[model samples]
Target: MSAARDSKSLSGIAINNSPHVQQLQKTAPPHLGLVCITFSKEVRFRTITRTRYLQLPEEQRETALKVLYRENLQRLDLALTFCVRNSIRLYRMPSGLFPMSDLEDEIGATVLEKMSADLAKIGQRAERLGIRMVLHPDQYVVLSSDSPHVVTTSLKILDRHARTLDLLGLPRSSWSLMNIHGGKSQRADQLVGVISELPENIKSRLTLENDEHAYSASEILQVCQRAEIPLVFDAHHHICHENLDSYDHPSVAEMLYAARETWANPDWQLVHISNGEEAFGDRKHSDLITAMPNVYREVPWIEVEAKHKEEAIARIASAGFF
Candidate 1:
C-alpha cells in the first residue's frame, strides 16, 4: 500500500527521529505498532506505581501525582504524533497511562477532571491521524478470577481503562480495541461466562488475545467464537503455548485465518508479533525482531513487542519483509 499522508508537527511536540520514520514507509496492509515506550531520548515516558504513591508523606504526594499524570498525558499526545509521522498505523497505549486513577477513589475523581481536556484532545488527534489505538490492560485485570474481591478489583482496573478511552473520545467500537488475555484461569467456559457479565461499553472494546502460558490460540478462539469477542492472534505466543499436544495442530497461517473471522470488518483485524528471547516459547521478548510470519503480510495491523521499539519496525522495513 502507499504510505500515509505526511505528518506535520503537532503543537511543537518534538518527535526525536522522524527522519528515520519518514524513510520506512509501508509497501503493504499490516502496519506495525510500537508497543508503548519509544527509543527517543528526548521524549522518555514515565509512569508511577500506586504503592510508591501511597508511601509518600501526604503533603509530598499531592504534587507528585499531578506531575506524573501531566507528564504522561503530554507523552501520550506526542506518541500519537510520532505514529503519524512514522507511518506506524497502530499504537498499544500503556495500560498504566494514568497512575492510580482508579485505585484511590478520592484521588482518581480529582485527577480525571484535571486530565479531561488533554485526553479529549489527544483522542481526536489519534483518529484524525488515522492512527489506530490499542490498549492491552496489564496483568492486574483478571476478570476470570472466581473470587469476588479479585474480580471486583479487576473490574475497577478495566473501568479505569475504559474511562481513559472515554475521555480520549475513542468510540466504544472496534475502531479502537482494548486487547487483553484470558487471564490466570484455564476454564474457557469461566472466561466466557465472565464476558457475559461485563458492561457493554467495556465489552464492546474488549478483544481476547492468546497468551503463551494460560491460553492457546484455539482455546481463546473458543471464547471468542462463543462470546463474540474478536481474537488477537499472537504469532510468537501461539508457537510457545503450553497446549500443543502430541496430535497435529494447525499452522500459524491457518490459526490466523481462523482468528480473522472473529472481526466484523476484516480490514481492521490485528495480530501481535514478538520474538522469543532465547528459544521459541520463552516469555522474554527479544530486543529486535529478526523476522515476521509470512501470514502476517495478509493481516491488517501488527503490534511489535520488541525492546528496541521503533528500531525493530525499521529493521523489517529496511529488509522489505512485508
Candidate 2:
C-alpha cells in the first residue's frame, strides 16, 4: 500500500454516539457492561449523564464511579486487542469513557491516579500495535456557545480529552485528533480567541469539523485557516448543507484539498462519511453507506457514521468503493 492510502485506513473504524444507535438498544444489565452499555456487547461504550450520576447517593457515588472508570479502561484495552486481531489501525476512543471525568480538576486528578497503570498499558499496546486514536466529543461541548458557562465547561471537557491522550502517550498533534464541530454561530473572534488561548496540548491536537447546520465547509475552512488547526470535512454533512451546490459542486474537491492542506501530515488528514437514512437531506445516518463522494478518494481516515457500526465498515470493505 502507498503511504498516501493505508489499506488499514481503507477499513474505517466505528463510533456509537449517533442517535439511531441509542434508539435501537436501551442499555442492558450492569453485569453485561458495568456502568455503561453498548449497542453490541463487542463494542462496549456509553455513559450515564452527569445529572443521573450526581443523583446517586453520596456514599455510593465514589464506589460506583470507580467501577465505571475501571471497566471503561478494560473495555478500551479489549478494543485495542480487537483492533490488533483485525489489523485495524484507526479507532475513535469514546468521548464519555470516564463518566463525569470533566466534573472538576480535583475529580480528574483523583480518577487519573487510580487508572495511571491501566492508561500506560493501553498506551503501550496502541503504540506497539500501530493504532491511531481519535475523539469526537459530545455535541453539547461547544466552544462557540454564546454562554460563558458553556464555554468554560467545554474547556474542561476538552482538557480532559487532551489529558487522556497525554496519559495514553499519543502525540500532541492532529495525528491524535480531538475533533469537534464549530456548532454555534458565535462571533469568529470569540471562538478564535478561545482556541488561541488553549494549552499547547489541547490546541496541538485540536481539529475543527463542519456540521450539517450552522457552520458550513466554507465557513469552517476559513476558521481552520485562521486558527491554524486542521479541518475534518464531513462529506455527507457538506452534501446535506453547504453554500456550495450539493455533490456536483466542483469546489467540493477544492474544499477537500484545502482542508487536507490544514493537516500537518498527509497520512493523518481526516474526513467523515455518512449518508442520510431516508432522504438525501435527512440528517439521520443510514445503517449502511450507499455512496461515497469520489472527491474523498485520496483522503486518509474517512470516519464512517452509520447505525450498524463495524458491520457497516465490513460491508463497505466488501463493497469495493475504494
Candidate 3:
C-alpha cells in the first residue's frame, strides 16, 4: 500500500464518543469503515457449522466451543491490528465469531463466561485504539415475522448478538450498533411493536436499515422513529427501492439528510455505500463505487458494504472520493 496521506488533511468525521475519535479528528482520515472479512491475508476465521459442533458429545462440544471461540478472538485481535496499520478505524465485527452462542445450555456457563471475558479484552483494545466496532446480523434475524415461532427464534438470535456485544464491553449506544433491515414489509407495524418489547439491552444498541425490496428509506425512517432507534441509510438500497430515474435524484438527498437526523448523537451517524449490479438493479454490491449521490459524501461514517471490501475502499481513497 502507498504511504497514507497526512491525517491533518483528512476529514474530522467522528463516530462514537471514544477519545480515539477525538484523537483521529486531528490525525486520521474520514470515518470510513469496512464490513467483516479482511482483504489482506493477516488472519481469518476457520469457522464451523453449529450443527457439526453440537453433534459432538457433551464433553467434546464444550471443548470445541472453547477452541473455536479462542481462535476467533485471536484472529479478531490480529484483524484489528491490521485495521490500525492500514488507517481503517471503523469495523463491523462478524456475527459468526461465536457460532450458535444462543445455545447457552449446551455450551455451559463456565465456558461462556470465559469466552466473554476473553472477547471483552479485544473490545477494550479497540476502544483504546479509537476504533469503532459494529455488527449486522444476517438477514434471517427477522424480529417481525408473523409466525410466533419465527419471532421467538429471531429474538434468540438477537439475544445472542446483544450478549456478544456486552461481553466485548462495547457501549450500548449508537456508536456500537447492530443494524438490520425492516423484515417482511407487511409486518412493519408488528415489527415496531416487537421492537418495543425487546430488552433494553438489545433495543438500545439496535439500528433499523432500509432494504432494497421490502422497505424504502421513507418507510423505514418511520419505524426507526417509532422504535427510537437510529437508521442506517444505504445509498445503493435507496436507489434500488426508491425507483429513482438517476442516482443523483432529489429523493436520495432528502432520505440521506432525514436518516442522518435519526441518529441520537451526530457523531454516531453511519451510512452504507454500495453499487448495484446491472440485472434488475440487483442488490449485489459491485467491486468499486464509481459514483455516489452527493448527499452521501456529507455523512460522518460510511460503511463500504461491497463485494471487494477493502479494495473497494482503496479505490475510493485512490479516486480522492473521501
Candidate 4:
C-alpha cells in the first residue's frame, strides 16, 4: 500500500473525532515554547558505554540509577525550574529507560513508583516556576507493527506508566504530551487504531512526530487529524530526510513555515531541532543549534539535540533563544 493509504487506514482505526482541529478553532494560536532535555551528555555516555546491563556491578548499578535520576529526572527538574523562573513555560523530558520493554528488570515497578513520586514533587515545583513538563517516548516503541506482540507490549508499557502517574494523583495532562514516530507504511492503519484506543485524557496529551524515514509533516498532520492527536515537527529530521540538498545550510525558516502550514495550527505547536552529522554512513547527533532568526517569529518549544548539552545551550543562548 502507499504511504497515504496506510496513513488513511491508521486514521480510520484511531480517530473518531477531531479534537485538535476543534481546539485550534476555539483558541488563538499560542506561541510555541522552547523545551530542552537536561543533562543529555551524561545519559548518552552511560547508555553507550556499556551494552550489557549485567556487565555492571552493584556499585555501577547504583551509579547508573543516580545518573539516570540526575539526568533524566533531577536535572530536568532543575532546568524546568530555571525556565519557569525565567518565564519559559514549556519543556520536554527525555523518555530514557523509564518505559522501555525491559522496565520490569532494568527499572522495576518500585523504581517507577518512586519516579512518579519524584515527578509529583517536580510538578509542584514546576507550578511554582510556571513550567509545563512533557514526557517524550523512546524511539523503539512503534505502534504500527504486524506483530501483535509489539502493539500489546507498547500498550502495556503505556498502561504501566499511566498507572504510575495516577498513583501520584497527577492529572493526565500533567505529563500528557508523548512523542511518537509515524510507523512503517504497512502498519499505519493499526497504529492509528492503537492511538484511538488511548483514553480520552491521554489522547488529549498525545502528539505524533515526523521522522526522517517514516512520514512528513503533511502526512503526519493528516494522520493526526484522523487520530485526534496533535502534530509535532522535528527540524533536523526534515532536513535529514527530505531536504538533504540543503543539509549544510538548511533553510530553517522556510521549513518551519512549511510545517506550520501543513499542520495549520497556531496553538503552542511543539517542535524539535537537532544537529546531525554523518557517522558510519548514518546521521548522528552533532553540536548544532537552530538559527534563531529563522524561528523567532514562531513560538516553538525547541530542544537542541546535539553531541553536547552545554554546547547546545551555548548555541541557543548565542542565537538569543533565551
Candidate 5:
C-alpha cells in the first residue's frame, strides 16, 4: 500500500526503534491499534472486580470497591507497559476501570482521588510512550435519553471519565476525547440540547460516534456539527446501518470525508475499522478483519475494534490491507 497522504506525522512513528514499528512505518498510516482487554494466557490480566460490589455486604461495599479500584489501576499500568513495549500507540480504555463510580456516587469521588497519583503516573507514562489513550463508556451511558434519570446518570459516568482524563493531566481537547454514540434517533435534537448545557468537564473533551443502529453517519454528523464535538467514523457501523458497502464506495467516502471535518485536530482524527460477522450479524465485529475499505488508508488513526484485540491487528498487517 502507498503511504497515506500525511501518515508519518499523524502516527508519531518517526523516532520509534521497535521492529513492530517498521510495520507501522510502511506506506499506510503508522498508528494502528486495538481497544481494551488484552487476550494473553501468560498475563491473565483483568481490570474489573471478580465480584460485584453491590453483591457484597453493605458494610463491605466501600472496602471492596477500594480494592477493586486499586487493582484496576495497577492492571492499567501493566496494560500501558505492554502497549509501549509492543509499540501500540492508540488504546481505548475499558470503562470498568473505575467500578461503581456511576451507581455509588458518594464514594466514587473519594475513591478516584485516592488513586489520582497512580492514574496520573499511568497517564504520564502513556504520554512518554507516545500512546494516544481514549475511553468509551458502555451503552448505558446515553446523554440523549428521554428519561431524566438516564441522562443524569449518564452525565455522572461521563463526568467520571472526564475527571479520570483530567487526573491523567490530559488536555481538554480531541486528544483525550471521551467518545459516545448518538443515542436513539428520535432524540438527536434533544441530545444536542442536553449536550449544550453540560459542564465544561464533559463538554470540552467529548466526541460523538456513528452507531450501526439508530443514527446514521449523516445524522451523527449533524449532531457533531451542532455540538462542536469530533465525530468518530466507524466503517463497519456505517456499512451495516448507513447502507454503504465499503469505505471506498463513493457515497461512503463522502460521508467519511465529512466525518473527518468534525475533528478539530487532523493529527488525532481517529476512526474505527472492523468487519462484521454475517449479513444478519453485521453489527458484530469479526475476530479478524477480512478486508478493510481502501478509503481508510489515509486516516490519522484507526482503532481496530475486532473481538481478537491485538491479534486482529496482526492479521490486518499480515493481510497487507493497509
Candidate 6:
C-alpha cells in the first residue's frame, strides 16, 4: 500500500477498532482551546530556501525576508479574521521561523530590531481583532544536550529575541508565550537554571513543551516547577512518548489530565494537535481534529501544523473547531 493509505490504515486500527477510543471520544472535555499556527501554501519560507543567503540576494535578502515576514503576518491576519468572524477565541502567532540557528547568521541585531518593529504592526492587527500571538521558540534547541555551549547559546539567542520583543513595545501578554522543548536527563537541570536566570519579564513568558522522547508531561511539569515557567503539551507527543498500553487511539483525556496535574491550571496549559498515522508519524497534511474532543469543545487555540494552511484551516473548520 501507499504510505498515506498505510498510515490511515494504521490510524484506523489504532483508533476505530479500540474500545478506549470510543469511550474517550464520548467523554469530551468541558473547557478546551484551538490554537493554530499561521501557515499557508504560498507563505512558508522553510522549504523555499535551503541556505539563508541563497534565499535572496545578499543586499536584498533582508528586505525579502521582511516582505516574506509581512506576507505571513497578513496571512495570519486573514486567518484570525476568519476565526473572529466564526467566533473562535484562540490562535498562535507564526513563530515566523524555526530553529533559531537557521536565522542566527542571517538575522543580526539590526534585522532583529526591524523584525520586532514589524511584529508590533502585526500584533496591533491581532489585538484589534482580539487574537493572541504566542511566539514559539525554535524546536531544535535541546536544553539537555551534553554540549553546554549549545544551551548557553540558545538562551542568549532567546534573550536577544526577548529584547526585541521589548523594543517593539508589544504587551507582555501578547508576545509572552515563548515555547521551548525541555531537553532530556541532566540537560534539563542546566537549562532550568538558565531559564530561571532570565530577566523576570522574559522568564514570565517562557513555556516548555514535552517532546516525543526527551521528556514526559509529568517530567516537564517538574522542570517547570523548578524554573517557574509555564507548560505546554502536545497531545500527540505524549502518546508517542508514553507508549501507553491502555488505549489504541490517542487518549485526549489522559493527555489533558497529564497537563492539568503537571501545569496546575488550564490557563497556563497549551495543547498542539496534528493529524498523523502511527506508522508514518505526523503526516504533513493529515487532519486529526475530529479525533480530538477537547479541540472541538474546550481548548482556546488549536494551531494546525499541516503541509499547507489552507488545507489545515479547511480541515479544522470542517471539523467544527471554528
Say which candidate scores most in TM-score: 3
Candidate 5 — which residues are off by over 4 angstroms? Answer: 1-30, 41-51, 279-281
lDDT of 1: 0.75
Q: Candidate 3 — number of clashing residue pairs?
A: 0
lDDT winner between candidates 1 and 2: 1
Pairs that clash in candidate 3: none
Clashing pairs in 4: 9-189, 10-189, 29-266, 30-267, 32-299, 32-300, 33-300, 33-301
Off by over 4 Å in 3: 1-29, 108-110
lDDT of 5 at 306: 82
What RMSD, rounded to one decimal, does every model reach?
A: 10.2, 10.4, 7.2, 9.7, 7.6, 6.7
RMSD of 1: 10.2
Model 3 lDDT per residue over 106-145, tens place: 4633565777778789989999999999999888888887
Selected candidate, larger lDDT, 3 vs 6: 3
Instruction: Give me candidate 1's TM-score against the actual structure.
Output: 0.85
lDDT of 2 by residue, 207-301 (tens): 99988787888899888889999998887788777533244345556667778777778567778877678765578988766666555555657
Candidate 3 lDDT:
0.76
For all candidates in order, the CA lDDT equals 0.75, 0.71, 0.76, 0.54, 0.74, 0.55
Residues 160-223, candidate 4, lDDT per residue (tens digit)? 5555445434566523466678777645677778888887655656678877777865666667
Ranking of all predicted structures according to lDDT, beginning with the best and ending with the worst: 3, 1, 5, 2, 6, 4
Candidate 1 weakest lDDT stretch, 10 residues: 1-10
- Candidates' TM-scores? 0.85, 0.84, 0.88, 0.66, 0.86, 0.68
Q: Write the per-residue lDDT of candidate 1 for residues 98-188, one digit (tens) a residue.
A: 7778865457547776778988988888888888888998887777876879888888888888888888999998768888889875778
Report lDDT (Cα) of residue 163, candidate 2.
88
Better of 4 and 5 by lDDT: 5
lDDT of 6 by residue, 1-322 (tens): 4212332222322334544332222233322223444333332333235365465566876665555555654665566676676555555544444223235555535555666656567567667776555667666466667778876666666666566556545565423477878865646677777776777656766778877777877778778777766667676666567764221234545455445444434544566765554433443325443344333244434555444444555555665433
What's the CA error at residue 319 for candidate 4, in Å? Answer: 2.6
Deviation in Å, model 4, residue 195 alpha carbon: 1.1
User: Mind sharing the TM-score for model 3?
Assistant: 0.88
